[model samples]
Target: MITFSKDFLWGAAASAPQTEGAALVDGKSPTVWDKWFELEPELFYEGVGPEQTSNTYYQYKEDVALMKKMALNSYRTSISWARILPDGRAVNVKAVQFYRDYFQEMKSNGIEPIINLFHFDMPWWLMEKGGWETRESIEAFAFYAQVVFEQFGDIIKKWTTFNEPLVHVECGYLGEAHYPKVVDFTRAIQVGYHTLLAHAMAVNRYKNSKYNDGEIGIILNLSPVYPKSTHVEDKKAAHITDLIYIRSFLDTVVHGYFPEELIQLFKTHQLLPKVEEEDKEIFQRNIVDFLGVNYYQPLRVQRPKKEQFPAQFPSAFASHYDWPNKKINPYRGWEIYPEGIYDLGMRLKNEYKNISWYVSENGMGVSEEERFLDESGVVQDSYRIDFLKEHLIMLQKAISEGSNCFGYHMWTFVDCWSWLNAYKNRYGFYRIDLENQFKRSEKASSLWLKQVIVENGFPMTDERKG
Candidate 1:
């Protein structure tokens, strides 16, 4: 009953820093993660750093073959800015050849490549120049994006300027989780504004480039905001939360402007970032062709009861609300709300001109997955299969009801290193045995997904029988 369209993109996504283990190899310079690990090795989980990842740089051919075996129509991954442009200004020919072969291998294996220009990894040299906080960094990013389009634009038809831009703004500037950790609300807004500007610049560049035949988009980690109750203050807080987290990037890229309410709030609080006279026009002129949404959980908020530690933080307007008895991923501690996908889809359809979108990343991460390995060495992860089915069923319903969603890509194809968490959690169709020479074996969920891809969708009432 829950069948997707014939041309639906059934795929998976991973980032360069997480998958490519050759962190310092072949003209690849240091990224923020590299420096952060160097500065504080004790911070990362189990002291595991970016150097010990899935080794996709060396094993991309085998990875692409696995994608073919799984019948994937697409695979989304980021081009390491540091790897491709070692110093953020010069192109690395070695990195270019590696990506060329990697992407070509995917195409040869019948998989379409969806390439993202930047994920959380910023070239350390760029960070030294103030990263996204300065206008210079924005221009640098535009130049880097241009080089990427020129290099791989023929092979990579689907492009994303950045993935989860808000994460860097919040995690890096507003919180201590990421590099250049500084608790500065004013700097956070600047970083976010500059990043959006860079995206607009990249979109404009791509539009006027010789490789203008393909589409360009930005990937957002969207989480629907829910008020704890129908109280006026709670509703107001929820709306503010939505404006901050979702609409900040979503509205700007799709509607070519930021939310006026968000602007007013920032102005009232004196948290506004400096802007150029031409920036407004620049944003109004450039809009994305499509959207790639990465949804893992929804945000529940209530009116703040008291002043938060960081008085200027977004949490001052709305505090987190723990929904009682909500189903959760124990390992990740994230609420499992499949219906959020339906709600998000409906919002896009009704508000955002029915923009074409796809689920760029969705998967369950479990810690200590080796405990689930059977005698045959396969990770018997039915939990992940159920998670995929439940989410996809909701997505299918949304599409059936006139949502313009075109595809669904899980979080990753193989288990890769997560920043900070490192390898504490595993989220992949192919389990990577770090101890056994990083051998990859398909999990039960992957087998189920292969059948779903083959059928274009899975049955709602019936199970995938052996």
Candidate 2:
């Protein structure tokens, strides 16, 4: 049997900006998403924006009830910075009460809440003030963290400073798929540096605050890098990709320092962000207590095909390679590699002091899932069940071999809006009917997961063991 610890957390994760529909209600200000959509509605998928999501702000009670129905012991969600501090100045009393009541509901339902302070939803005012590119913006974020910790720290014991800070840097600054759409490498590095500094500052605040009993962490979307071939050039390309994408943030948050190679490389390229003298001390002193890993796919890279790609950032050193025999999620185009989970676990155990962590986000996203709905109106998503089971088998093997993994939380509980893609891909245990009155229904995977949670694992059949 593939067994997990009795205390293992079994749940799902969602974010306020993705799940909450009241974008403009109760003194909430616009996030960068709202502003971006307003500026260029055509850029988003089918005119869908962040304005109307799953409507969890009002239906949080129903959402909690659904979580209980799925037998979830824990649930991870983010507090919208814009919702709480709409103007980026003072507290919004109504927003505070709303979150307090929502969290209290989760606690009452036997659900442990893992709350994240930021999830790429920068308040428009803060973004206008230069976002994370400026030290002033970093300071504002730390202050906002202090405020959130002060208000809800007593209820939510598990906290995450940011969800996928790298995505914020890459998508917004480098890729132009997200808001502000700047493709400058220098600005991207600065934004990434300041964001990490913000995380460290928040960790410092939470550790020193009265809520020290609670554990604090950061969610990183870590992809294990692989070389395209055994050639020295390919290996070198993979190592550089690992340093830039993985170690840059992972090392600093866990080991209290940046990778020396990364620093030197950035310095050589004149891409280093401005650093204050006291920042190093703060980072060393405020290392995260735990980590939340959002693993979707591994990276495969080879030596740069040309001297300089259009991006001229990491592409200058490495080029992405499509593995010949890789399985893929056709709907989303992400490589589906279950073994990568095991690889990540072993890497953490061996190199990172065996830090306590959890699978904060892992799930299969399918496009137009309604095509698979059964006659009873439920989504018969057996593909998701198979996906989860395959990943769990690998995860169980990792834990058996001594990885300090504590839990598994899927990408989301209900279908929620994804940035730019909007609802193009559905990744949820409960299918939210956008065409209807935002009604939610269960998928086959939710039922399968409920049983797995009840048993603390699944039976290891011959096929699974193989």
Candidate 3:
């Protein structure tokens, strides 16, 4: 049988832009996502943008009620930078009131509010001023973090500096998925560097204020890197890939320095970001109190059989291969390897000295899920239940083996808009009926999860086979 600790946290996470639809209303300015969708509507599926999201701003009460039904004791939500700091500098009073009310409601429902400061929603105004590329903009972010901590200090305690820093830097700078899609590795390195500094500054402020006995940390999406073959070159490729993608941010805020080989690789290619002497001290002083890990899938890499095309980033230097005949999420095109979570957990325990951590984001995203709706208007998403069950079992195995993990938050609470992908992939426990004024219906997985949370865990025979 699989069981979790009585203190284990069971929750779901959602970001503001993906859930809150009042994008420009109530004194809220534009986030980078808001502006990006305006400029490149074609980039998003079905031309849907942040403004037409799950309308969480207005529907949060109903959502929280549903969360209570699911027995979610801890819920993670990001505070939009644009909503709080409309112009990137001046404070937005109305936005502050909204968040205060939001936090109050969550507390009223007995749900722990785990607030994240940034979740890729950089204000459009700041992006115009070079965004994370400049230290001045980094200071702007730090000030914004101070504003949030000061305002909601009494209600919220678990504060995350940023959600998925690598995703922000990689997708927005090197890849074409996110806003300001500049294909420059040098710029990516710069953004990545400043993001770590911003996190450090925020952590410093969080500790200095000591608000509500708060614990501050950053959420990172980590995946174990694997070599496709037993060849030496392939193993080397995987090692380098892991350093660039995982350790670049992990080692910096955790250890106050970049991985030697990662920095050397950047220096070898002259891709180092401009850094000031004061950054060293800042990085050293503001280590995280805990870690929030968002693990979805692992990366399998191989050495290039032929000379790869000239690339500007380390990720592009290596070729990737899917596991031979492995199970996969057919809808989202991602390989399903539940044991990878165990691998990541062990790595943190061994290498990171067993820092306290939690599974912040882990769930399956399925497209066109409406087809699974039964005649009774409920989605029999038993598949989603299986996905969660398999993953949770692995998480339990790690915890029993001495990993300092205490929480498990699925990817989302309700069906919310995803970036670039928009509403194509549904990861919510409650299926949002777009045709019926966004009416929420609980899928089978939600009911199962509610029971799992209620019982702290479920027996091994509980998961029904498809």
In candidate 3, which residue ranges exceed 4 Å CA deviation? 210-212, 305-311, 464-466
| Residue-level lDDT tens digits of model 2 in 1-466 | 8889889999999999999988889999999998998999998899999986999988999989999998999999999999899887789999999999999999999999999999999999988989888889878988999999999989989999999999999998998887789998999999999999999999988987877798999999999999999999999999989999999999999999999999888877778888999999988998988999999999999999887533357798899999999999999899999999999999999999999999999989999898988888888888888899899999999999999999999998999999999999999999998886368999888888888888788886623210
Question: What TM-score would you give candidate 3 relative to the actual structure?
Answer: 0.97
Q: List the residue pairs that clash in candidate 3.
A: none
**What 10-residue stretch in candidate 1 is worst by lDDT?**
457-466
RMSD of 3: 1.6
Error of 3 at 190 (Å): 0.6
Distance (Å) between predicted and true CA of 182, model 3? 0.9
Candidate 2, which ten residues in sequence have the lowest lDDT sum? 457-466
Candidate 1 error regions (>4 Å): 307-311
lDDT for model 2:
0.91
CA lDDT, every model vs. true structure: 0.91, 0.91, 0.88
Clashing residue pairs, candidate 2? Answer: none
Per-model TM values vs. the true structure: 0.98, 0.98, 0.97
Residues 42-135 of candidate 3: C-alpha lDDT, one tens digit per residue:
8899998887788888878888999998899999999988888887677889888888998999999999999998999988888888888877
